[model samples]
Target chain A: MDTDATYQAPSVDEIKTLLTERFAGKVNVTKTETRRVYATLPKEIVHEVCEYIHEKLTFEHISTVIGVDMVDYMQVVYHISNYHTGTMIELTTNLDNHDLHVQSISDIWVGGNWHERETYELFGIIFDGHPKLERLLTPDTYEFYPFRKSYKLRGQE
Target chain B: MAKDVLDIKAESAVMDTDKMWIIMGPQHPFSHGLWTLKIQVDGEIVKDAEPIVGYLHRGWEKEAEARSYPKIIPMADRLCYAASMTYTHLFCMTVEKALDIDVPEKAKYIRIVADEICRIQSHLMWLAAVGTDLGNFTVFLWCMREREFFMDLNVRLCGARMTTNYPRIGGVRNDTTELFDRDVMRCVERFEKVLMDDIVTLIDDSSVFVSRMKGVGYLTREQTVNLGITGPAMRGAGVDFDIRRDDPYDNYDKIDFDVPVMTQGDSYSRYQVRIEEMLQSCKIIRQAVQKVKALGKNAPYRLKVPSNVPAGRSTVRLEDPRGESLMYLISDGTDKPYRLKVRSPIFTNVSAAKPLVQGCRIADVPVVMAMIDMCLGETDR
Candidate 1:
């Protein structure tokens, strides 16, 4: 999904500069496109970015968080929306699929916990510090991650 | 003292014993479409509950990617069958947003009428099912009798009953007929008196229903918000947040009606809210019908949508009869959507059952679940 209509877009340089100034280089801001910015930071800095966006950039609500498998890597996308400013920032991170480790953002937004558990159950993504990481939708005996690209549907493998 | 010690030991032994688990259907009376709930109960009192989904999962998101833009309308209707029109309307609105298609004023008014009719029919069905759950079969008969009028009205307009694939990507399938307007008015007038009185006599007057439902399945406003509950359940919790009012789609902003919120947040409150909501829906339908009649048949009904929609994501929230139905549509400038995610209300409402049924008796489970009135198709899809 690429957009070419660059109408005074938010500058990546300014975003990166702000992140560096606030987070002291612990945060890595990667530019996906003129409109999409993917911020990857240490698990410890998740709260910091969440807090900074909520307070400074006015990203008031977490739209959704999608967990995807890149085969060897697991990617978690935090889709944040600034309803007042009409801007969206998709923060993403890649971790080893087997490790599947990350801190929970439930403390920031209470709604994040259920979605996180759903992702965990579907893709085997592990939220390290989540309050309850037990199976949310699937059966307890469900062994395989159902949403992975390689994960075959019934009788398809 | 020795007997007391022995009694304590016997109770501990009973608690430690292996409990029998019963798997209630992906097909059952309680389940509408397809979903399973695994329950571990020690003789009626449930110790634990787990919801098992993905039975009716057709991977609609993947299907949407393969289907052309206009072709996905029918599929959206199948997501929530009871309120099929709402799903189709939401999908159309989302695609219209992506393609930047402006619908005609006449089309908007017609759509509002159709959707409000769907809401009335859906709530009527809910009332029937809720009545059936409470061991009152006559209410179901009365509700179905009243509901047939609207169903016939819908068939007269769109030529279908349950699944009316009447809404299109740009606008709607057809213009309203003179007969359609007459039948709708007839249905509205009949429902205004008969159905309201029947609901009050059948449900509100019954002491059994009141005793069983008055304080059962309670969810506080704070808990409801935390659980992401929407629609009537959230309104029953006293939130007063209706998408029709908060984020007005179609001509909901122009219409006049109260959301009918209840502070009790119990099963009874939910039933009362839904009963009141049916009346409010009738009011909206009356206003929309008036608007449609004024516009007449010559008003524009069709719209033109671009072949390649703009590459953007849009989230459209509409007030479905059950709850707040959110559709997240992502397009990559192609005929097919890149991702189509549905945030169904039933899924969240059903999840709240885990907390609602924690200490209640087993007999109360069915009544409590009926109050939620979750359609398994919506939850699984």
Candidate 2:
């Protein structure tokens, strides 16, 4: 009980290899920084990837979700962390431009509920299986996707 | 009026008393910020709590896309008025990473000093709020009296008292003086003697206070991580995880301090964790002050960089007084940021309240919430 387990965060390359070996070309992995590992998986495997990281890799918490409107398609970036290993993984999945929908990982991480809703409202990207998809920060009557490229700020001049 | 169309129940003509929806804010005494807690109550017990934020949302991310890189520092300070320095420091660090600017060694120590000081300030403010939430008016008075000490130190270090846009992109706005160091140490000493020793004993010894806090707001260890709870709240659940000790940002790795953790996972345990954390913050400052002093008084505090920042996307996360705050900034070779996404700690912490207070009694809601130490500015941002 007394021995504090000293954890050294794994290298990005190691995580890349681990994911590649596990998924076998189903996903693309890249390293933005030493501590941050970015993996771009298909929309179909988003929930699987989240479950793998949460249950298997022990990445206990989803830090937050960031949605970007990349013109051609919408992208949902998930910042997940494993407290024990002190590793951060950024998982990105693209959504359809016309539909702007993808699978929700809320059940994988209960904390993802509000984050998914925020993404749904701000970027207009829908989480397919979210229990309740509604506006969080914006007013319920307000119907603008504020984070999208189409929505402009008040003082843009 | 709410149930005008519903089938009539015995002795109830207008509303049903079985399961009622109660909007607990925007201006309620229980809510500290301009947000509502829609708690589904069945008489004395709370069935559910749905935290509704956005009452004070200013669309900071949308505004950041138009503003230049350096101008966002002041805006960040408003994210959490109670812990302005922490928010500003996280924002500066994010933008600095995007620009790849090197902060001076002196500035590194100074930023840590400012951050830990804000930790003390925030904890004291929460202490006062917690006291006010409970019927302990004396605790509020004593806490405000003690908070003035650090607020004085904050103003002395930075010109402004509360909204301190002190930490800049590269370093800080200015260097702190030798007198600032002396004043910080003096205040910390008095706080340890007065608040940590005397006031703590006065509160902890009260059987009523202890009984009220203990065994209330039970969040299991697994539930905490699953719900993304961090900071002192997670520590109270017996999870030994602190970003300072684990991540070791700025000069935290150089300093020696223990991450205070308790296993009770209740309001009382959270109270103890924060009180202990203030003492630890003071300890960190004690070491950080010496490190800053050893660097000599005339050492450079901030660095000079170009007016226009380079284009890149970078994100940085740091431990806030409540939990973790992150700023993800994207630049596109322009003076202004392409996009800036802020993941304020309270956003997730407050969201977790629904699950945490699921089966808690109606009376325990305020106690549970005050223990969360929410800042609506941060949550709604």
Candidate 3:
């Protein structure tokens, strides 16, 4: 086991500044709370932004990927965590209704593979270049994306 | 006899040999829950594997979207029966964050006590599963025996044993019952002794148990982090992070406890991490109970918040027994949440089944997988 005794993790401001400097206007650091950073990124630059976070910032883990269906658009939320600093960055990306597609980050963080698969199955979001972007936790035969807001509950009209 | 044996070997050598895929669950005893593991095996060795979950999905997340905030408390209780309080507590915490209200001091201490108790109960259940998976009924029986005391503790705190819907949005359901602190201290002290003296001795002294879990299912610290594993499993792999300590919430920062981490990235280390965690939880329970008592009985345990949450987003993560479980809430200024997403620990941990079971013998599959401590309730949800 290697001890990280000398490793110094940058504070939240440093991370925000680093990201804003790298991605410029493409990356927007919306909110910064205790041990948490909320950022919004356009779908076009998600892949590069995530690569920078993983490779440079040392955010080792991807906590989860959540897909939400808005009436007019779609959203993908990625929670990335850096254990060294105990800080989590919430990366939210907006997708147009016509193109519910985004680059897959499974190559950078292997854990995102299953989460992408789940998002694809539930919200019909296509994760381009994902290793196996198939239905997960849902039957392949099930045609409908049950999680979409348009899909009504069992008793609802 | 030598000539006949040589003839038989020569004939058998010409026969075709190929890898076979064996599906192991959804009904198999090796799977503690409703899930299947399809393992590709060449003779006794597993070359690759796939885990299929969701037999119990029941559309939990979507179901939550339709129900009101308070109505989902009992539903959250059903997320994982083994450690229901943690899920409910997590759900309530997320809502409270959206509501932007702080629970009273007494409620925070009580939650800590309840959460620690739930952690012990969940770990004990996992230990029992590990025992049975490793072919030792005695260990299973003993663990279940110890777990029953915790279940009784749960009953004393709330009213239910398995799914104790004790945590409300602003606070817990109620304050500690009469003599609840006394009962918890007694149980924790007795359990500490039995676990250290009897259970630890039985497993540590037995060479069979030691050898079975010592080196099987190895994962490096990098792999553990990259694969998004958390909780004790990640701690065992040498990533020193615990949400309770590093990312404190709900008076966790106020409490003092040590997060047990093992550098060895093997099954045995994972087992040892959980065992040490149970002991640490005992220490936490003791301190938290005293804090609850210090606050006096008049202290408020539950706060009355508004029926509707403000339109916003709140995300909260807690150190669950299995791993770091997170809940993300999106409210639309209504009683019903716009979206409720649960990131179950087992959901990600089980995704690494291919790496976890690969390269091990078929017989070792159960023992190795047991270390992840499968729970379909939360995984499917």
Highest TM-score: which candidate? 3
* Model 2 misplaced regions, further than 4 Å: A1-13, A155-157, B1-17
Q: Of the candidates numbered 1 and 3, which has the greater lDDT value?
A: 3
Give the candidate number with the greatest lDDT.
3
* Candidate 1 lDDT, B96-199, residue by residue in tens: 87777789888898899989889989988988888788889998898988888888878987999989999887888899876777788888998989976776
lDDT of 2 by residue, B58-119 (tens): 88888877787788888889888999999899888887887787788889989998999999
Q: Which ten residues in a row have the lowest lDDT in candidate 1 chain B?
A: B57-66
DockQ, candidate 1, comes to 0.17
The ten-residue window of minimal lDDT in model 3 chain B covers B2-11
Weakest 10 consecutive residues of candidate 2 chain A by summed lDDT = A1-10
Candidate 3, B1-381: lDDT as tens digits: 766556767777886778899999989888998999999998899999999998998899999998999999999999999989999999999999999999999988899999999999999999999898988999999999999999999999988899898999888888889999999999999999999999999999999999999999999999999998888888999999999999999988888899999999999999999999999999899999999999998999999999999999999999999999999999999999999999999999999999988999999999888998899999999
lDDT of each: 0.75, 0.84, 0.92
Among all candidates shown, the one with the greatest DockQ: 3
lDDT of 1: 0.75
